[model samples]
Target chain A: MADTATASATGGSEPAIGRGLKGLLLVALPVFLVGWLIIYPIIAAIVSTLFVEATDGVQFSTASYRFFFSDPYSRANLALTLWTTGVCAVLLLLVGLPIALYLRFSTSRFADLVQSLAIFPMFVPSIILSYALIRTIGPNGTVDILLNAVGLPKIPSPYLTPWGPVIGLVWDNLPLTVLMLTAGLAGISNSAVEAARDVGAGPIRVFWHIILPRMGNSILVTISFTVLGIFSSFTLPYVLGPASPEMMGPFMLRTFNDLYDPLNAKTQAVISFVFCLFFGIFYVWSIARNQRSQSR
Target chain B: MNRREFLAAGSAVAAASALPSLALADDKTIQVYSGSDNNIIDFWNNTIIPAFQKANPGMKVKLVDAGDDNGLRAIADRALAALKSKADPQADVFENFDARLPAGGVEAGLWVTFSAENVPSYGKINRAAIDMPQQLPYRGSQVLLAYDKTKLDPKDAPKTWEQLVAWVKKNPGQFIYNRPDKGGSGGNFVRRAIHEVNGRDPSKFTIANFSADYAEKSLTPAWAVLKDMAPFLYEKGAYTSGNTQSIQLLSQGVVTMVPVWSDQVLQAMSQGVLPETTGLVQLTDLALCGGFSRLTVFSNGANKDAALKLADFLLTSEMQSAVITQIGGFPGVTWDNVAADLREKYKDVVPNSIPTFPGGDWNAAINDGWYRNVATGLARG
Candidate 1:
């Protein structure tokens, strides 16, 4: 019985590639496509940045990378991208976690409504969200008018400020964050919480001891995905953020289009890729670890 | 199905889907890709193409709406690639082509040069309007200071760059321009500011005369001037994103004045998006940068002859007059060359001279520098 269970769990006791020719043929097209479409362009871009055309001939140079690191404006843009990504990730977790927790524990019909509401942002396009944000919180917009009606002091708007992109990104990222966290919460059985509480552990103790650790992988996955999404976001940042000290997405675009400097644009892109590599590594490691533990 | 039968079906489907487009690519068909607005697109599809086709039967004109600057740039890049590979460029005539695009294509001979011998109407084009031999100038519009006449008296309107600055400062938070990179109205305004800081001489900057060092030295003072004036701008240095937004601000009574394109403002007023009380004025010291929209024939286009015929047809007296009446643009041909009635009708609005800012590197430098020095330097309210 144990042998049969293990055999079925490990795919009918066969070596992974035992199907050989048929399996290879099935995977060939997709593998070729990924290599051609994704890996090849990334490699080409990185290689292009390494080589520079000098007066004498095409020579190896790190001038583009050096310029990106040394330039103050470029550094500021990179710093802004990192800062915004960090802030949005934190905000997403803070806003998404409680709702997810409530949905997981609650039996009320309102929980269904709450879950749907939490995931509603997924349907809203970023451009439409940007426009809607501007209308709600922009200068002389709905918020301002309401505040004026109540005779409150006028507040400064976030539009065209660094906060603009942050607000939009957090709102845009909330749905995915909630979905991931909710799925993680769903895995912790109610009996686990009941078991902890019956041992005289309070609600806080039950949550801290019985719930948080189990959802650790989901939280990490959420942070990784959120950071990646916010880092490379273009439309929200372009429409909402300040002209200077912009995110890398807009910076690379302006460099390529407005400034008409393709080499610097490629250099900017490579730097962005390098920055995102850390999160990419974390995400892959987390997934692999999860798979290993699941198999065990 | 068996693998062989499925493969045959897939191949047949692919060929069937491709057949129509292959049939459409014939010798008699010429594709004219235009990046102009819907009004201009309508002018081409409804007016120009029909008229041209009527005159030359059996010659089909396919109008491809290239959408915007980026779209046109993509098409230009395709042409450049085709030039390198020695293939047909698929596109023939490019309307509203910025000749400086695709970096070095002009120098690489990607477009056909025009002269009276090739395009008969070329001789009648205004010498001042013609910027290059490769471009055929067809229509134009200039940037002007557009104000709400109902609010600000016309007599108090700014007629020079210095006065414009003074006026903006006098009425704080009542004037705005867009980010220079986002729109040409604001770009021309910034160009005029550059000219103003450099002793009002528009001659110093040229298409080829751009270097990082030169830009740093020449643009520092202009940056200082713009930065100094930013606090008085709408919402204390908040700039709108585009030309339409600037006009929208003016219409909303949020701003009293903005730099706007002549054609756009007129159209907006006619459409009632802008009030009828909106007024336009050109600076007397130096007119804000205005440019002619030029069409170019691709050197490697398969339908070069048909394209050239269309280009010549665009400059005819009837078409030039229609350009004024239909699109609210100044005629590309000289006043004397156009119909007498149009010359009389538009005499009041004819510019003394349209000071054009060079595009290639100068344009990119000014836009980038404006963001770095001017927009970024605004003090938060």
Candidate 2:
């Protein structure tokens, strides 16, 4: 492995100009594809929202944006979305980081079982997960029946509340966070950990100084992804969240489909994309930093 | 050649290449886009379309079901988008429930207008159904009370709006209707309550021109009554989100009663999702809101004449009766024309006429208002 790495390193030192042109050639196709597929639709959506159609003709107008911002429900929905996404991302870090750490360091059979369990949700579609959560936690559902069987009072199902999405989002985001963290931990050197332990540093101290610094980019990626996923999510929050303080996903859908307000829906979608960029910037920054480090 | 001549040559080549496919598409085949239930689609494809094709030799009809994911609303959204862009729509006929597509298609000039002169079946259709502009009524559905008979005796069931309130008060958590924005049955239930609470007259709410001021003034009593009734709903102040959800609750005995579409309940009963003892009630005091799903011919379509012929064929007695027997829907034509057995079965619950769904803007306002004033008001109170 060392010989192969050395050979590749030596080979990689070829003249910068040729390598740079080759690199650009390889990336050009992907950049063009991304621009066409992702950037074009985004530009179209923004442009569509900027124009207003009247009896005479289409003209430049902020009518859609004004309509969306003017509605109290839209403002409430935005806040609720931020709250749900923020809380879920934080909770996932608190819960998932420890699990990832344990899975990374331990080799026990229980750790292997835990690893399998953590990734089990990756196979389950969000819609199926939503329904499963409903059937398990809904009124007169499995949990209710179990509680009744044990002669216990049935607590109202949380599946219809804000906690519902929190639970679902945490579960949904777990696999990806764990996978990223585990991969990140693999890159972390064992010599540093051993040295820290040899020097009599405690577990928390080692984690704080040695592990946390190494996992910075991974942590950012996980948190940013979790926030983005929850913010733009539709099926889970729509099925789980309360109707009045709806998240932007279901709210925008209802506005466009049921209320027949396409313009407002498009405006709301643009607003959501703008909000996502707040977290999305971290992802962009992480990628740029990684690219810069690699180039160096 | 110059750049202009070269570009013209390229354009000519592209157009020539596209000629065969375009010709194939305009080969007199009528395309119908429907988001109707599977059973209705089966009846149309198996019985109606084949018969219509045979009657009109050298003509073809194609039925496109939107499947489970893309429903009537999705189809309407796509069609409307195409119409707004002034492009030819893919389908000739657009069929779906009134609430899902609404009569707004007619008002927007998206549908072809029909009268007795153009459509012979119009003479057989009920006069009340005929006057709906640009709408061709093909099947009827009414919002009705569906109850588990094992839990409540049919004789003891609520027969009027007042009786329903009293019964609900007596037995709380035993009934539920979906949120109005979520399902047509629930929306109609709210609309009916609004009409019944103030007065028994349907005329009061059936204004030709919708006035928001008049609605606010007249519907004050309705809001009060709905607010009062909300607490007694199943799961205390909580409610289901859709017609299927409420029906599932009923089937599970989670709730003994729910407001559901009559035809939907029938279909569910046949499928065993609902028990044998389930029964339906149409209140006498407040008329159950009822309307027919329309088979609309798109104004900008490839085959207009064939589409019109297919629409006419759908309204005939044979197809209308098939709608009842196969799909559990009321006939679009005069009630007397329906099969005797099916008519007798649905006699008690059959509505006298199709109720008008308020104009699109009015509907949007009312649905939003109810969500704010009634649905949330109950929760807070």
For each candidate, the alpha-carbon lDDT, in order, equals: 0.86, 0.79
TM-score, cand. 1: 0.91
Give one digit per residue, the lDDT tens place, for model 1 in B264-340: 88788889989889988889989898878999899889889888998999899888887888777888888776788
**Chain A, model 1: TM:** 0.92
Error of 2 at B245 (Å): 1.3
The top-ranked prediction according to lDDT is 1
Clashing pairs in 1: none
Q: What is the lDDT of candidate 2?
A: 0.79
lDDT of 1 by residue, A1-296 (tens): 99899998877667667768668888999999999998898899988889878899888999999999998888988988998999889888999999899989999999999888888999999999987887778767778879989999657878778888999999999989999999999989989899898889997888789999999999999999999988999999888887778889989988998988889999999989987889999999998988898999
Complex DockQ, candidate 2: 0.27
Kindly report which residue stretches of model 2 are placed more than 4 angstroms away from their true locations once superposed.
Answer: A1-72, A108-116, A199-206, A289-296, B1-23, B26-28, B50-59, B67-90, B97-110, B206-208, B377-381
Put down candidate 2 lDDT per residue, A1-296, tens digits, no spaces. 99778869888756789899989988999999999998998898899999777788989999878877787667877877888888888888888889989998998899989999999999999988987887787767888889999999987777456777778888888899889888888878889999999999999999999999988888898888778888999888876656557788988888876677878888999999998888899899997887788699
The CA lDDT at B77 in model 2 is 63
Q: For residues B277-347, write the lDDT of model 2, one tens digit per residue.
A: 99888887666787677777777776877888888888877788887777777777898876788778767
Q: Which pairs in model 2 have colliding backbones?
A: none
